[model samples]
Target: MILLLLLLLPAPALSAPGRTRATIPGDVPVVVEANHLLRKGEGTLVASGAVLVTRGNDTLRAHQAWYDPRSGELRAEGGETEARVMARVDEGEGPLAIEAGQVTRLGSGRLRASGAVHLTRGQDTLQAHEAEYDPASGEVQAWGGESRARVTARLAGETPLTVEAGRVTRVAAGVVRAFEGVVVTSDEETLRAEQAEYDPQGGELTATGAVTLEAPQGRVQGERVVYNLRTRVIAGGEVAAAVPAPDPEADVTYHLRGQSIRGAWKGEPGSGLPQEIVLERGRFTTCESPRPHFSVDAREIVLRPGQRVVGKGVGVSLFGTRLLTLPRIAVDLSGEKDAPGLFPRLSLGQPDTVGLRSDWRGTLPLGGAASGYAVLSARHLFRIGAGIDRFGSVPFGLRAGYKEEASSRFVSGLTLTVLPAFTFYLPAAWSPDGPLQVGLERMPPSARLYSGDIEGERWAPGRRYRLIASGCAGRFSEHPTEVTANRLSFSGALEVRPFGVLPRVQVGGALRGRVGYYSTGTRYGVVSPELSLYWEPSRRDRLRLDWRHQIARGTTPFFFDRIDAERSLVLEWRNRTPRRALALKAELDADNGGLYAWEIGYSRRLECLQPGIVLSQRGGDFGIGFTLEIPGLSTGF
Candidate 1:
C-alpha cells in the first residue's frame, strides 16, 4: 500500500528529495492503487498497473511508478489511459491540474513533466510540450511545442483573453509572465509586445518592449502599456494611436501620436470612442502614408469626445513647415480650410448699427470643458468668456456673466448696456441645483424691469416623476411697465411618466403652476396642465406633440384659478438618415383661434460643410436662415 500510494500521490511537501526537514500532515488519508506494490522502507515504493495516489488536496495517477527509498525519487510512466502522468493540486481554487506523457518527482520540491504538458484551472489553461513545477514555491515554467503554446484566461465576463509567447512562466499564483514574441488577444483587440505579464487576481495587465495594439479604433504602438481592470483605465508611454473615422464608410482616420496616453473606457480598446483621454507631447494628423502631410503638435492635449477637445502649446504644420503656432484651441481637424481665411460676416435686416451686427468668434482650449473664447464684436460689444467643466456630468462650472443687451451706441451706458453678474453651479450628482444669479442694473428690460433680483430652483430626482420648483423676488422698476410692482414670482412643475411601453412610444405630462404678486397691488396666478407625446419608430425618425393651455380671469372669475381653458398645440417631425436630416414644426394658438408659427428645416452633410436652410413664419414676419458646419467638429452652444 505504501509503494502504491507513493505511485499515485507524491509525499507531502517535506518528503520531496532534498529538504532537510519534512512536515508531513498526518490528517490526510493517502489512498493508493496498483497491480503490484513493493516497499523497501517508509520512503521506498515501487508500483505497477493502475497506479494512483491521493494526498491532501492533491492527487497523481499513472499506470506505473518507481520510487527509491534513498533519494526519495518517484517516476510515473504511461500505459493504459495512455497511463498519462497527471497532477491535480487543489490550492483553494478548484485545482491546478498538470498532465503530461511522462512525470518525474525529484523529491526536493521539484517535478518535471515532458511531452504533452498542459495545465488548467477553471477558465484558465496553459499548454506546452514540456513544463516544470516547484512544489515549494508553486511556480510553473513551460516551453512550447513545435508551435507556440498559449495561456487563456477569462476576466469580468467580458471575453476570454488568450496569450502566447516563446516562453511562459507562472512564478506566483494568479500571475503569469510570458516572454519573447508575446501576444495577447481579447475580442477583436490584439496586443503584441516583447514580453507581457498578466495577474488575473489583481486585475492588472502590462506589456513592454515595442508594444503594439490593434483594435477597431486603428492601431497603437508604444513602449509599454499598463491596464487595470478595476480602474477601467489604459495607460501607456511613448504611444501612437491611429483612430479611423467612426463611420466605417469614411476614408479618413486620425493618427494621434503622443509620448503617453491615459484614459478610462469600457469598450474593448478603440471600438468605443473614449472620453477623459489625456495625451502629452502629442501630434494629430490624418495622413497614414510613410510621412504625414500635416500635423498639429502640442505640448499637452485632453479630449472628452462629444464634449470638447483641447490642445495647448500647439503648432499646426503643413508638411514640415509650421503654418500656424498658437498657445491652444479647439483646432478643427476636418481636413478643410476653416472657411478659407477671415471671411467677413455681413448681416442684413438690422437697423443702422455701429458695431458689427454679429460677433466673430474664436476659441482656445485651456482645460476640460473650459476654454477662452473671444467674440470680436465692436470694441463696445466685444466680450471674453470661459467656463469650467459641465455641471450636469462633471463637477464645477460658471454659467455666464450678466451681460445686458446693447442699446444703440449713442444711448448705451454701462448701467443700461451691461450688468455685473455671475452664476455658479453647486456640485451634485443626477440633478442640477445651487444656481443663483444677482444682476445689478443688468435686468431684462422686457420683464417690466427688475433690480437686485435673485432666482434659484430645486428639483426632485427621478424619471418616473420629476418635479421642479423655482422662485424669484426683486424690486420692480418704478417706471412705466410695472411701476407699482415690487415683484415676486414662483413657478413649479411636476411631470410624470405614465407609460413605459415598447415600440418606443413615450407619453408624459406636467402640471405647472405660476403665481406672481406686486407690493403695490397687481397680482396674477394660474395653473396649467401640459401634455407631451413622442414617437420614435426607428433610429432615424421621430415625432413629438406638445399641448399647453393658459387661463386668465373669466367674465365672472372665481377666487382661485382653475385649469387653463385656452389651448395651445405644437407638433414637430424629424427624419434623419446617414447624411441628411429634415424637420418640421407647427404651432396653433386655440385661445385666440390663430396660428402661432411654423418652421421647416433641412440639413445635409456635404463634402466641405453641412449646409442647412431654415424657413419660418412667426407672427407676421417671414425669415430665412442658412447654416454651415464643418463636419466632425464642434458646432453649437
Candidate 2:
C-alpha cells in the first residue's frame, strides 16, 4: 500500500542546528523564525510557539519570537501570548495591535515600540508608556508616565472619546498635537488646553497656550481658540474673553474683551440657543456715575440671546450731563422704559408792581401723551398802572400779556391795553374738552363802545355738568343829543357738582341783566348777581370765594330819579410747599358801604424767602405796605 503509507506521513519536516524558516508574502501562510543563519550577513531567530506574520493586508501574531535578518529586527514576547497587528491604511477595522513589547522596522514606514504598547482602531483604544508608529503615514505618537498616555474613542452613539495629554503628537494624517495639560472630552464640550490641535481630517478644533472653552453656553477665555465641528464655528483670539449674566445695576460689567470673538449656535436641538456673539474692537459701559451715563464704541458688536447689544460708537449722559451723540446704539435686554426731555428755562421776576419782570414758560407734548401737557408764555409787565386825580385832572395806565399753549388743544393769545382802552385777541379756542369763546371790541368815539362776543360750552352728560352762556351787545356813540346808547347783556349759569363727596368741591351761581335806552333822558337799568366758591385741595391747593351784587336805575342830569347799590366780597388762596415751596396769592375785599381791602402775596421759591402784606381803607385814607422776597434772585418760567 505504498510502503505502508510512508510510515503514517508526518516525520520529515525538522531542520534544527543553524535554524531557519521564512516565508511571509501574502495569501495567509507566513512563518519567520530562525536560530542562527546569517543569510546575507547575519541572523538570529528564536520562535517557540505560534508565531505568524503576513504582509500585504498585514497580519502579525506571536507567542515568543525574535528575528534579525541583520537588523530588520522584529521582536515579540508574551507570557500569556496574544498579538494581532493589521493595517489597511486606517479606516474601520485596520491598524490594530495587542500585547506588543518590542517591534522595530524603521525604514521610512517607521514602527518602534519599547515595552507594553497597545493600539487598536475602530472602537479605538490606545495605551502607551512610549510609542512611535507610522505605517506609511497612518500615524500614532504617544508618551507616558504621570498616568501613562491613554486615549479612548467609541463614537457612533457616542460616550467614550477621551484623551489626556502630557505630550502627544501625530502631526500629519488626521493631525493631533497636544502638550502639557490638555484634556478633551466628548459628550458635547469639555476642553482645557495649554496647547491643543486636533483635526480628525479637518473636523477641526484648535487651541493655543492658555485656552479654555467650556460648553453649555458659557466660558471662553483665550489666547487662541478655534473650533469647527463641521461648521458650528467658534473662534477666539488675543485676550478674548466672555462673561454673561451678572448685573448688579450693571455699570459696565457685561464682558466680552476682544481682538476677535465669534460664536454661533442657532435654533432647534436642546434649545439653549444662546451663542450669537460677534465682537471685534468692542466696548460697553453702563455708567454708575463717576462720570458715565452711557457709553459704547464698536467697529463691530452684535450680541443676541437677551444680552442684546447692537452697537456702533454711541455715547449718552445725564447727571454727568451730555445728552446723546450716537452713530448707532441699541440695547434692549427687553425691559423698556425711557423718559427724557424738560431742561429748558428762562426767567426774571418781581411779581407785583410788575417792575423789572420777565416770564417765559415751556412744556410740550400733548397728543403723544408723555403726561399730556402744553404751555408757553411771554410776559413783560414793567409798569402796569391806573391813575386818576379828580379836580386836578390826570389819568394813566398800561397792560401787556402774551400766552401760548401749543397743544393741549391749541391756544395762542394776547391781551394789550393802555389807559382803559385797546384790547386784542384774534385767535381762540381752549379745551379741557372744548369750551369755546371769542371776544372783540373797539372804542374811541370819545370813549363810547362797540363790541362783539361769542361763547360756547357743552358738557351735560356726566362730564361733571356744565351749561354757561353769554351774549353781549353794545353801541354807544357819544350822545350830546344825537343821542345813541344801545346796550344789552344776557347771561346764564348752572355748573354744579355741589360736593358729591367733594371732588374738589365747587358751588356756582350767576344771574345777570342789563338794558339801556337813551335819546337823552338817559334811561338805563342794571341787575347783577353772582356767587361762586371753588376749592381744589391738591394739584397744588387753591380756594376761592366770590360774591357780587349791583343794582342801578338812572334818569340824567345830576339825578332825576337815580338810585345805585353795590355789594362785593372776594377772597382767594393758593398753596404749594416743600422743595418748590410756593404759596402765593391773597386778596380780600369787602364793600357794601363799609369798604375794606386786604392784599398779601409771595412768589419766589426754591430756597425760599418771602413776605408781602397790604391793607387799605379807601374813603378815610388808611394804608399799610411791606414786601421783600428773594428766591436766589428768582428766575424761572
Q: Per-residue alpha-carbon lDDT of model 1 for 1-637, expressed as tens digits? A: 0000012234433222321221223445444556676665666676776666665667777777776645656678786666587777665334567777888878584778777776766545666777777766767777775665544323222445777777778764657788878888877778899999877666677999999887765677899988665555778989887666554443445567788988763445555655456789998655555566556689988765333456789887655778767776564333322211111122111111222222112332453344322334333355333334444433222222222232121222221122222323222323333432111111111111122222222223333454444455443232111122344566555656545455688887778776766564667776678888898988778899989876644221111112323687989998866467688998887766766678788878664345667676654445455554334442210
Q: What's the CA error at residue 157 for candidate 1, in Å? A: 14
As a TM-score, model 1 comes out at 0.54
Model 2 lDDT on a 0 to 1 scale:
0.44
The residue pairs found clashing in candidate 2 are 34-45
Model 1 is weakest, by summed lDDT over 10 consecutive residues, at 440-449
- Residues 58-165 of candidate 2: C-alpha lDDT, one tens digit per residue: 444455555554444555554364443322222222444543555554434365655555555545555556666665555667677556544432222123335577
lDDT of each: 0.56, 0.44
Clashing pairs in 1: 8-52, 8-53, 9-53, 16-107, 17-107, 17-108, 18-108, 329-365
